[model samples]
Target chain A: MKTKKIATYGLLVSLAFILSYLESLFPIPIPIPGIKIGVANLVVMIALYGFGSTQAFVLSIIRIILVGFTFGNLSTMMYSLAGGLLSCLLMILFKKLKFFSMVGVSIIGGISHNIGQILMAILILESASIINYLPALLITGTITGTLIGIIGGLIEKRLKKFLVNY
Target chain B: MIKKNDFILIGIILAIVLLIWSLSFFKINWPMNFFMKTEGSKVRITVDGQEYKILDLDKDTTFSIEQENGKFNTFEIRDGYVDMIDASCPDKICVHQKEIHYDHETIVCLPNKVVLEIIDGQVNEVDSVAN
Candidate 1:
């Protein structure tokens, strides 16, 4: 691990942590539980494109753990872990396929993140009726994912100039 | 930078959403109601997957449940709708959720492990025949 790479990881992780904190402070007006714009995901997507899958995975895990402990409880941490891991894996897989652009990959990530949390909720609550929120969640996820992907695409272009050779 | 596949993906997702929305819509609006009459419905409360209480929707009343962990949730039944009025949970998502009146509608408080669902009050002969 190069020192530059390590420093970038630290910076990105802190950025993600701050975004998580800001997000928690102002919950989305929607009353639905486990719905978030996932701003921290922008950092993860950047890491995935600018860095690599391993770095993105590491950054996502660290961010979730840090944010979970700082702003949430054990159960919240579990939910974040489930959503984070699933979304990260899917984003990586989609990126590898090369069929979709950053926007496409991020949209998949957003949708999977919600699905992961809902699945966790179903397991913990032991109730299948909670699945009723899936359509709304999916729609929100898609919209938010598209927005984040657009922003990520813009950032990636500028970041490429500075982050040449990883 | 969007790609052709991205549009296709969005289309597929919208299609799935439409399918699910229509399915749930039809289940609640058309065929089920045509066969089984909703003479009345009751609010079924559960804690940790166990039945807690069943409240009549016709009679307006407020009810509260105290969990073993000292957490609590309070709900009100009014005019055939069940609404979660208060909760000790930090998120309070259940309290903010829309009031449920239709059968199978639910308001769940995960932190408190409380679930409020609407179920048919009395099973009629039509329901039995369909079953």
Candidate 2:
């Protein structure tokens, strides 16, 4: 059981890293700084549902670090850490509530991710004016988060069946 | 499994987003028109919450400001419109943003802590008139 759990975590980490790398390849035309499809969150979402919060937290941290080292700088790492940590916390909260499914949890995670990064931007810049972008960010977060949630729900269902057979 | 309630929740969230989105479009024009009655507006630049400089929109000029932290942003004011043509910030969000001519519009460079706001020069004139 121990070996299986470790193996699952290792695989999840690699999968998340690969998804982040793939996400960077797609260039979004919008110049808005903290906007992206966030394909990597899908992996995190799946991990949270499949294994649990502890494993999901570990996977998220490792994925952010590896992605930062490979494709980002110090500021990028700071933003990712802030966003990823908050998103993970919210996801766990919603998951425990049991009021919402994978889709709802993922949506909350996505929106929290943007809020965390925006807060970091405010602190780093020392400017309250950055709050001007809140409306647009929230809209984008909900749209992208819903899409990610749908994908995560489908994968989680498949993974459950596969794990049972294995 | 996504329950029926989840869809309702998402719908409510979307409605809230739609309201906020629409509100941004209706930004108060009262103050904007009040300021526009004057011949020209002034562009106020602030760095780290300190008033840096104010430029008249009547002049066509390009100027640059170098912050104490070594970052800089360049602005080009032409025909009463100001544009952030260049910035030393990592993301360059200000440079990519559209030019502004209306009163109270702002071009903000968060990484460099620079804020270029279009203020009504007439407000000061009005204050002086009151005095």
Candidate 3:
């Protein structure tokens, strides 16, 4: 059982990395530095509900490291790390709260992720002017985050059944 | 099945999208410069505010601009240069897009809360177009 769990987690990590990289290929055309589709979070969401928070958290970290090594883009890696960490934390918190449902948790996680990246940007730029972009980022973040979260939620539900049977 | 709250949230989202879409036409500003000149045309760009320009689009001929706010704004060339593009803003999402190509469309730098759009060339159409 232990070996199976470890192998399963490894598979999930690889799947997540692939999904994330695939999503990265989608050209947003905006070129605002660090905007992404958040597709890999779907896997995180699945792991969160189906595999448990601890497992999901582990998967997230591993995925982040793999992506960072593969892309070798420091700026993107920083954003991903900050955003992914905050998002995972938020998702877990919201899940515990049981207030808005898993989808809501995922959305909130997405928003936190963007905000984290923006904050990181502000610090790196050493200019408060970047804060001006908050409203716009928030608006976009919420919209995209929600969509991603819902998709993740659905996948999580489906995975729950599969995991139980397996 | 989506709950009533989810339904309401969706409605709210639609309303916000519509509102933002409509507000996009309010005033789009593209960062530019009339005084700065490249090899041939005038340049309009946004920088760290250390450098700025005042362009007379109607009075100058062959003007060029360098983007200041990165990808926040888009530019278009018509009788005059206009900024029209989409953005990542939930509201300003369409505001900070690629600048336009025709006489219409504009670029907006929402992070800078700036809008760059085109105006009628009637001010000094030929004189400014030269820059």
Best by DockQ: 1
Tens digits of per-residue lDDT, candidate 1, B9-83, equal: 989999998987787665553222435455448888889878989888889998989877679999988888888
- In terms of lDDT, the best-performing candidate is 1
List candidate 2 segments past 4 Å from native: A162-166, B29-106, B109-114, B117-131
What 10-residue stretch in candidate 1 chain A is worst by lDDT? A124-133
By TM-score, the best candidate is 1
When sorted by DockQ, best at the front, the candidate numbers are: 1, 2, 3
DockQ for model 3 equals 0.06
lDDT per residue for candidate 2 within A54-78, as digits (tens), equals 9889999999999999999998899
Error of 2 at A28 (Å): 1.5
For each candidate, the DockQ is 0.38, 0.33, 0.06
Put down candidate 1 lDDT per residue, A7-33, tens digits, no spaces.
Answer: 888899999999999999989866455
TM-score for chain B of all predictions: 0.64, 0.65, 0.36
Please list all clashing residue pairs in model 1, or write none if there are none.
none
The residue ranges of model 3 lying beyond 4 angstroms of the native Cα positions read: B1-131
